[model samples]
Target chain A: MEWLQNFLPLTFDRAVVWIGVLCTIAIYSLLYRENPFYRFFEHMYIGLAAGYSLGPLGVDILYRYWIEPIWVQGYWAWAFVVPFGLYLYFIYSERYGWVSRLVIGLLIGASAGLFFQEFSSRYLVQLNSTLQRPLWFSASNPDLTVGNLIQNYIFLAILLTVMTYFTFSYQQKGTVKGIATAGRWFLMIGLGAIFGNTVMARMALLIGRAYYILSDWLLIRVGG
Target chain B: MQPQTIWQKMLAVDRRLLYVLLLVNIVMFLLVPVRMPASISPPVQKFYDTIEALQPGDLVMISSNWSASTLAENQPQLEAVIKHLMRKKARFSIISIEAQSRDISYRLAERVTKAEGYEYGRDWVHFGFVPNLTVAIKGMVTDLPNTIKQDVRGTRVSQIEMLKGVNSLRQYKLVIDVTPSGTVPIWISYSPKEVNIIYCPTSVMAAEAYTYLDSGQIKGMVTGAKGAQEYEQLLGIVGLASRFTNAISFSHVLIITFILLGNVAMFMNRLAERREA
Candidate 1:
């Protein structure tokens, strides 16, 4: 702990405090108006991120999809080279833009095939299971707590009401209307919860930035 | 409509004021260090317990799929989990779907694991980023060697000392996912049924996971930064997650206050309309 305390030379760490203070000041300039310094870093952050992502991405695509085939598999896998070569030609010739579509089409097809199965298994199965639970099941046998029982009943209600809200099998009947009305209330609760969480998350981000300013910069120098 | 009250009028603060006040709260708290114990959510506790109970030499698969933006939350969770694994002497491998996570988690793991003298390639190997999680999982399931030709640095996976006997997901005792995305389902869907899958989702990502948590599809979860803190407590190590969550918990209280205030303002506005009518 003491080693870390003195790890940074006092002069060096003090110098760090100065730059941190300057950045803190620039960050507060965000309060006044958009300045070049702020915009510079903002765009630089974006550009750097894009560069980082694209660099690895370029290497991965060229290595896995192109170079590996040529180097490892040799001329036997050369058939893939033509379309791959064609996909790269769109930059030089506008007419070859359609060739890029072939690549896009394959991407879309693969995505669709995967997502179709995902959509069914995740969404459909979940929805169906929501509809089929036994309403009368006890939460606890001997060891089951009252809290467990209440949770089960609440789940049962939410399931039935929410499902009925989507039902359109026949003209609204008495039970159906009651269920639909219940679903509407449940929907309101759900929406409110979502909105609350969203606000919390937004505030969290702001807090993080403010933290960088006050704690990392100001407090560090002053407290030290 | 009801008559408007004075307190109710105050509730209708401007949206910008709400935002500024939030920024202030964050700034105020960040300057101060407060340590508060968290109410351990079931899933988070389960995640902690699982790692705590692991025996030495157990193999774990860690899928880290978050990036720098989520560093405030996900970084702490990754650090705590890795620290726990190191303490347990667990042999592990990390693989990522996102390219950034591959580099980030690799560096993070190397730093923490090195502190414990846990040798890389022998104890833990980073397979690094793959373009597709599903295809990778399928390949790792059916044929580990054919799918992953090389590690992140172009070394063969077969040759990596950590994965010497690890042919498939079935060989790993636990699969821990630290992500802010919905990639958990892919693991549940593709990984072998024999291996256990646990989760670490951002706080906002936790609610949707209750459905899976209830069904036992995911064995447990460490939710957001707070969950990371509880895990730190369980391990007897205070780290960044605990520090960050102090602000988060207080932030939760602040947001709740504003919501109530807003509702009060809306109620008053309705009452004023009634009175005018």
Candidate 2:
């Protein structure tokens, strides 16, 4: 018993790392073949993630916004906010499903209101930037060099072609079709670039796991 | 059945073998002591310059909204950004929309700050997790104190020594959204126009952000671990990104090789079938 105890992690931090190692190995086991170890850890991870969220939700959100205001701050009006939100669950009740719409309507109305600002803030800035690009270098825009001028021309060309591709007003024929095809090719190239970045990101994640195993568990110095 | 051709055998290779090869490649490269130099992209350089321009004690809001799922990409980005901020002697406050991020970022920042002798309340603070980004940004824009009533430690935001006079997001010098999510749009939509916004998006999210970068909506960007590596080069310190650079770069080469090998095998298999026909 003493020997077994000595072999086990005696400290809390060490125990945590031990569990982390076990979980990591169990999760990665699925790469070889589906097995019970992977399934067990997978389910445990989902359950733990959901349960862990409640801790922060209670302390940071529910307690701070809902409970504290009603109980401590005497903002009694804030008390009904949760129950009003819970009205959304009425959708499950055949008789009271209409009650759910009240919450849904509030959400829709709020989202619609938010969209006004969102559209103006998000898209308008980009539009302004597109329109503001100087196609040719000038004295007034001395900072816009030969490289920037060429970039702006390429950007505008792609922008128009892509927009033209999505134009559903009429059937694209001859030159319009040719431009649209070019747009499609450009989009494919963009998507390829994105996929390339995705591969890089996935590799980084694998490297991270390997680093953990080497540096944390095996006590090997990684990356010198 | 007749003996299978080499091309057919290559085509029928188990996917598990590919995974093992990738794992081996990453592990081998991770152990390699050689540090590769990164070519700094314009966006990464701009990201560095934005922080370097920050005067001492200038307030910045860090929207750290990434969890352990994106730890490999976002962790190094956040670490490098935090180190840069601390170097500039900036007083920053972090807000997390992701629940796990609140704890992860807070713990990470604490560990980083501890080594640098950075004080918690006066020098930096974590406002903890807020459920919604859109509503939170709008609230912080109008009333920072009332919106974020308390820090993660339960101290009132108004009573915090550093935030005594800060009541609106407009007062902050900069907003840095360190995320793997699309929450930057909300910040762009609602944040004070005076404050410069920057981004640290995971590589997958980086492609879509170019339009914003072009628009100058975000003053700068750091796109994932590779970007972080370039940033570390600029900062002249060997951090996690610097350490992980060799592995990530080499892994890309490995994947490209795999792709080319698969394509060649397929082409050769097709040509053999044509000859047999």
Candidate 3:
């Protein structure tokens, strides 16, 4: 044990950093070729993440919310909560399959109720904002600048075209067909933009790992 | 002897070699001591102004729900925001809906707050990790203390000096959500209307947030590392985002170049085959 300690980084923090570097390399090695080293580390990483979450779940959620309330605070009503949640596992039972549906039904009902508030609060504000957009310049609205007016017009046009594209109630024809085609083009452009951003996001995650190796492990100072 | 053509070689280049090239490009740029300035976007400016509007001793809730996976992007945003809040003398509390983020954000906030001479329970506190964000936010809207119950240190929120008279979420002035997840919709739906919201989403998540930004539901946004770099410029500080920006920008250039090269190679190969035919 003493020899092992001496062989490793002296401080716990440094040891953790070393372990992180090793794990990063092990995982990235798969980019070259599939191998046992990469496989082992990949599984280990997933397991570690899942295991790490249990600590917080136990301390923060279970003990703090459920167990403590029942045992210490004498909230007897809370005692049934865990067992009731456990009924979800009855999904595998041949005879007791109906037991799981109770939990599923309760969850669906709760979600449905919550979604009512969610839809109203979430969409209504957006609808109000969209409708309230000033299409043309007005003297009463002093804040409406030329730039804002133009932007609002562009926004209104795009909104109308996009909404028209999604209208499947009637077959599109003539000018409506052209407008729907324009909306489809607009949607493709939006999707392309999203794809570009997704690429940027993935690149950032890669750069982050590379930065870690250079700065933290190699002790190199990066850009200011 | 048929010599290999440049187009043939380019088409058949090993993917591993490309990965190595990218790695080297990133490392080389990272080691350079130069800094590139970022232009401030309207969303970032609005985000800065919203925080600047906060008065001293005003309460703010920081919903930090990102983990190691997004540390590069989210950390700089969180650091810059916290520094600005501390500068404003605003008392704040952090809560994490993500289990892994609990410890990560706690340690990060501790490091940041400690440097600014901020006291724990007096100036700021961590409410720790909660399992469900939607339910928690809804509950906190009605009863803050009962919903959160206690701080990370096991101190009852009612006893915390900073939380005095903060009976509900309505008492808070701002909710800054730094996340890579889709939790902003939940906050908008459940949190108090009077309290404004600022978003810090990863780049992939930012495009979808524009509608919300247009709707005024989210007052402002900082999009990923690029956005963080812009925010740091606005604050006149050189933070992680600035350090990581060069590599990010250069990497994009490299990827785009390879994409163009690949297309050109494909066209050349097809032409050569036609000539042979």
Candidate 4:
């Protein structure tokens, strides 16, 4: 028990980590063989996560939509939640599934309404930004400044080529064909880069896990 | 016996040998543990400079969205950023979108901040975890206290010491996201223009963020372990990130070299095949 606080001078986070490391190994053990240990931890994790989320999520709903405005700000009546409560019971049977449509409809409508508005600003803006030539005004010959210009051009080429390769148009002819082929090659290169980086990231994660198994669990107990 | 045959021999070298070479390279670098000060990229420098410019009593929002598995990259970045914020006496609040991050980042921040005399509720608060970053951001933008009603300790946000004045997200000067995920765009879109967004994405996430860095959407970025190493140098502390980057940088050089040799071998093998035909 004294050892649980062993992370203080160095980390001060032993309690959760002690449990989490064992859980991680349990989860990963499925790769070798399925056992009661993995399921026990897995279910416990899911249950804990569900329980943990309920309070904050409940607060978000109550504080945002109901309590603050009605009680503190003095905006509306408490009776407004009556219909909302009815909306939750539509799962009783197939016949009443349409009862829940009111809730689903609003959600879908909001999502659909905001889709293009949000996409245009976030994604389209990013797309437009990526299209700029790195050469602020063309670097001195091919020798180039080799800085933002190189960075910008690489981003633009990667984005454009990756987009083109995903285009499913079958009009394969001339420059379109050439562009498509180039796009395919560029996409392959991009994927290769992602794969390489992914390997490094995964290796880093593995190293962290190993440190936990060796240094954290064995050498010293953790603290929270 | 022929030049073509020699090329074929080189081309047919066992891939496991390359793997062994890499393992040796990484192991050797790890043992030496050189904290080579990186040539700070513009984005990383900007990230450092942003923290350097913070004034006392300034409020910042930190979204800690990474777990322990990302400790090699995200943990160091967060530590460095938190150190800066605390050094400047900038009161900050942390929120996590991931469940583990809430515990991991919050506890880690609490640990780091305590040494700096950062009193909970006064100088630093943890808002716990929330799913749906987009919806949460919108809510926080609209009503900060209501959206994040409780501190990680379960105290109301309004009751929290430093957060009493923070009615909405507009009050914060900066939103520094120390994450492996690319959630900066959400903050960029929803938050008020007054709030500057800095990023701390893992190396894989950093390349994509260069576009944002170029566009100035994100103030700057700390890329992976290398960025953390550069940050550690700036902080004058030797941490895990500095240690890991030795392995990473040498690995990068190794990969680049392999790519070059692979191309050369491919060309030679093509010549050999043609000659045989």
Candidate 5:
């Protein structure tokens, strides 16, 4: 082991990088064919990620929020917080599963309350912006140029068509059916754009790993 | 009795071979000395301007919630944003909703700030990881010190010099959410109305955010590595994003080419089968 370390860049940082490179290779081996090496690394990666999160959970959350207050600040009531949270695990009990609903209900109530503010803050502004769009050239908002006006009209068309497609209350007529078809086409285009971006994002991840191997591990200077 | 048709052969090309070809293409682009400039998108331009408008000593909250899986995109965005904040002499703190991000962002910030002489407690801090951002943001909006309680190092939030007078989330001027997750809506919904938000999402998450950007809920955005590359250009510094941009651009080209070829092969194979019939 000592000789192995000596033969390679054996410093702690370098060693970690080497291990990471090996892990990367092991993980990528699955692309060729599923093998034990890939499976071992795959499990190891998941396990390591789970284990690593415990450090922050303990130090940042459990210790800072729970333990320190109880021990140093003499806040005895803080101790009950964890036990109360543990009631969620009561869901596993066949006999007392109803007890877990208390926690779930509390969470749902809190989330529902929070969602009111979320709805107003997140969607209202968008609604306002949509309504405030300058359909034609206006003196009040001089910056709303010709191009913006055209774009706004296009936006309105798409919004109306898409909304019509989702309107299930009435039987769509001939014109309505055409608009709904156009809406579906628009949605497909939007989805294709999303798929394109997704491909780019996935490629970036692969490129990142390759860059790590070539530049970090091999000490190859890539890109000026 | 006869040689295989070109379309049949093309259709039958091994997926492993395609993977190897893609790997080679990426490696070649990564190693190539050439650099392709990025056209600054509206979102990236807005993102740059939003940060550039920040005055010195103004507090900024960075919600770094990306793990190692997105290091390629998020790392460059964070690095560029941090450097920009430091250059402006802004007081900033990072909070991570993801546990892994807490350490990764902290270490990355430490490395970046150490070179720029930004002090830990006085100039910047890491609030560590919180289990939930919605709860944390709401709590911090009401009582920042009581909610976060302490920094990652166990130092009380009150003791941290940068947060000396900061009592609520309203005191912060900007919130930069660097994430591959959908936590931006929570920040927008729950955080104080005064604090403007900017987003840095992975490319896949960027499309959904356009509506938010259009509405001014988020002041700006940087979408993945390509966005980062544009941001680096605006900053006038060649960083990891700039380095990765060529490979990123070429990989898209490779994928698109393959898709077109596949379609052509399919069409030709169908035509040949019709002729045989």
Candidate 6:
């Protein structure tokens, strides 16, 4: 038994790598066909992900923010925060469901209050930027060259047409319909660009898995 | 049934066969000894310049909110950014809203920083996972020490020598958001206006962020692994981004080739059907 153990010689790190390799193969096996092995790993992955989050939530959030403050720092008022948050679970109880709305109302109020600032900082800044762009070159805008001026004009045209496409208050007729059609074309092109980027993103994910297999598992020397 | 034409047969090829082809293409390119340098995009160049401008000991905040699902895209970006920060001798702290991201970024930063002889708590720190980004941002803006409370190591934020004078988000020179979510708007909304924000978004999120870039809300961006490759080129380092570049580039080419072929086959098959009619 001792001789066999010595000969095999599996370290903790190598075992981890082996398990990772197994999991990867199991997950990717679904590409061939749906099977029990794939479903088992898929379920295991979801369970592990959920369980993994609890560790951080406990250590980083509950311990640091809730428990430690009350116990160590003597911020006793902090103790109620979690219980209050947990009140949301009361929504499952028919008789006590009214208790849940108290938490819901708090959340909605906070979000609405935050949105006021979000609106000004987010959309207002963009609006200001759109209005500020120079359509043509001028001495005052010395930094803005002919190329930038042309680009700015194109941006303005796209912005207006896209907004026109979204306008549903009035009936479309003649020139308005023509502009809306053009807007739809522009939107299609924009969505196409986004879809192309999405493909690149998905491909990067696959390449990442390949890198892990070759570099980490197979012990091959990929580029730095 | 009528005998199928070559185009019709091509159109009927199994989907699994295409998946195998892509897998082969990626592995082949990944193992190729040859490396191609990427042309630097304007956003990546700006991202570099922003870090280059950082003075030694200038504090920076990193919002790393991506999990293993986006490891290929976000990992390279995070690593390149960390290396650049170390080179600039900047002090930085990482925060994550995604629970899984907290551990991944923390461990990745630990490995990278250790290699560079960057001391934890002194040169860099991790704030761990926050459940809510908006509340966390608002709290940090008001009172950083009280909000974050402690580092991942259990050291109080105020006790960390590197963060001695840092009591609010306003003190940080810059904020780098490495995420695959729309968390950037929250940062743009609530973070101190004085601190400049740069973004590293997965390719899918990159399109929506262009408006922010145009508005100068974000100083710059690094879009997924392709952008990371460009950044690695700018940094003159051959990190994971460099390794993955060939695979990503060639895979795109393969996809385009197959798309064109499929379209042609469909067109020819339609013509044949019309003739039969």
Task: Predict model 6's lDDT versus the native.
Answer: 0.93
Q: Give one digit per residue, the lDDT tens place, for model 3 in A100-215.
A: 99999999999999999999989998899988988776777879988998999888888889899999999999999999998898899899888888889888888888888877
**TM-score of the second chain in each model?**
0.93, 0.97, 0.96, 0.92, 0.98, 0.98
Q: What's model 1's lDDT at A209?
A: 54
Model 2, which residues run further than 4 Å from truth? A1-8, B1-3
User: For model 6, how does the per-residue alpha-carbon lDDT over B98-128 read when each residue is reduced to its tens digit?
Assistant: 9999989999999999999999999999999
Which tens-of-lDDT digit does each residue in A116-222 have in candidate 5? 89889988889999999988776798898778889999999999999999999999989999999899898999999899889899999999999999888887799
Task: Using TM-score as the measure, name the better of candidate 1 and candidate 4.
Answer: 1
The TM-score of the first chain in every model comes to 0.60, 0.93, 0.89, 0.65, 0.93, 0.91
How close to the true structure is residue B199 of candidate 2, measured as C-alpha lDDT?
97
Taken over the whole model, the C-alpha lDDT of each candidate is 0.75, 0.91, 0.92, 0.75, 0.93, 0.93
Alpha carbon lDDT at B151, candidate 1: 74
TM-score of 4: 0.75
Residue-level lDDT tens digits of model 3 in B20-63: 99999988888889988888899999999999999999999999
Give the per-residue Cα lDDT of candidate 1 at A212: 54
Q: What would the per-residue lDDT of candidate 6 be over residues A1-224, giving only the tens digit for each residue?
A: 65445323287876787788789899999999999999999999999999999999999988998899899989999878989999999999999999999999999998899999999999999999999998776788989977898899889888888889999999988999888888899999999989999999999999999989888777777753
CAPRI-wise, candidate 3 is medium
**Number of the candidate with higher lDDT, 3 or 4:** 3
lDDT of 5 by residue, B60-154 (tens): 99999999989998999999999999989999999999999999999999999999999999999999999999989989999999999999888
- Show where candidate 1 strays beyond 4 Å: A1-41, A72-145, A214-224, B1-16
**Local accuracy of candidate 1 as per-residue lDDT tens digits, B26-63:** 65565565577777777888888788778999999999
Off by over 4 Å in 4: A1-92, A127-170, A217-224, B1-34, B249-277
DockQ of each: 0.26, 0.80, 0.74, 0.20, 0.84, 0.74
Number of the top DockQ candidate: 5
